[model samples]
Target: MYSQSHFVKALELLILLVVYLAYGSSYRSSSLYLYVTISIWFLVFCWLFAPFVFNPSCFEWHKTVDDWIDWWKWMGNRGGIDLAPEQSWEAWWMSEHEHLKNATIHSLLLEFILSLRFLIYQYGIVYHLHVVHGNKSFMVYALSWLVIAIARVTKGCFIGEREVCHEASNCVPHPQGHRLSCPHRFTVPSVRCF
Candidate 1:
């Protein structure tokens, strides 16, 4: 049986998928760009939902590393104390695994919020450029693609940072004090509106 949280998350994703599909179909003409964008967005939506739908208990833990080039074994360790019963090695792993899974679910939700904004920019900007104004100039196409690429890349970075912040803030030592460990204001997608 799915928990209430899982239901809520699935419902939210379903709503988004419906909205994107409806908008894509109703929008002017069957433009390849619009459909492709929606398809990609839909895949993202599915990716977010797959964990909850398929195997809620088996999500692999992933930590965000700040330094890619100067990586170390410590880079993967978040320094969080796992309080699970010390029965065996498997127990220890499972304890940390569960913590990571919960954190990932929360971070994924935040990312979904940002993805919504990106969806708006993706469909709205593309529609306006490719269809509404009827300006099929190469410059317009290039600009649309550019904005779309930026939004996608920036969204990934924001989500990764959030996951890192989530792990750090929950660490036993509370790395670098609360202010330093807690996620930045950017995690809140509403702030991006400004």
Candidate 2:
């Protein structure tokens, strides 16, 4: 009874799951292996079960508005009128739900696989830059890694917060402007670039 689209989706999911399992089991330590297994399971659940199990209809509507508002807000909140087109709640509701369901699956493969790949590359870079180099080069390379790591961590945290707000429906409306509502608020105030 599976349609072509369904078969394609299922095949993609199976392939990703196999790859993750292979990578996960290559770890030697029991604790690390267990952690990896749990992490993968949690990610799969989030990408598969979350859409249906956690208020599919509402989540979809919320996500649609969230995306539109986020884009509108990014454009200095100037085109408010253009962004205010009335949408059919029911149609929006169904579309949002379907979008969320697909997003969950897509994100699982994209985010988890890419994050793992990046981490591997980062570790290799750090090893080559510090461990393989002598004095001067080591210090320079280590500092570069430190700066990049800090930037990545800071960006990741802010993105996480914004995602939480998108899911929770309690995003604060800034009086100054939409740009003012940027996730930079979650980051340290002292680090402003000006």
Candidate 3:
């Protein structure tokens, strides 16, 4: 059986492919198809070869930094009180200090790659529109893509373990953090903490 992470990743790739297809012939000519296929293949290659091409130490450090953010957020909310003054200070200090220490050169390099991915996505959209349908009626789609990209970057940098928090209030310091607890509310009472 496929693990949940595998399923999720596959679903995400499927959605990207579907969107590429749905944009229709106006968006999916031979050249566009080739470009999109190559882009997807490149992402897959990076994911598969990251351990070999990149330093495993660096990847672990990045993951640790991400986990530290969640730990601080959890520590802030563990006692069911929101924004206890001391806890807020603790969370902020710990998060900032850990981020400073853990944001290694490798992490920055990976971030640069991700930024390039965003640029590719943006330009791909424009190229598809320009070549396929030639209809520029929907500048809004491009704007939406930009917004989503910004949100994704902000979320990755600040939110940590995106699975745990859907809203800024849940991951960010706020006076009413408790009010913004996971909306799903499905309890796993015996789950082990890593």
| Cα displacement (Å) at residue 45, model 1 | 21
Q: Which residue pairs come into collision in candidate 3?
A: 26-132, 26-133
What are the RMSD figures for all models against the true structure? 16.1, 15.2, 14.1
Q: In terms of lDDT, which candidate is strongest?
A: 3
Evaluation by TM-score, superior candidate among 1 and 2: 2
What lDDT is reached at residue 149 by model 2? 84
Model 1, runs deviating above 4 Å: 1-132, 166-179, 182-194
TM-score of each: 0.25, 0.25, 0.31
Kindly list the per-residue Cα lDDT of model 2 for residues 80-185, writing each as its tens digit.
Answer: 2123323333233344345446577777677578558555645544553344464455575678679888888887665454455455443554564233243545
In model 3, which runs have C-alpha deviations exceeding 4 angstroms? Answer: 1-4, 24-101, 130-194
TM-score of 2: 0.25
- In model 2, the runs with Cα more than 4 Å from the true position are 1-36, 43-53, 58-67, 74-125, 128-137, 140-194
Q: Which ten residues in a row have the lowest lDDT in candidate 1?
A: 185-194
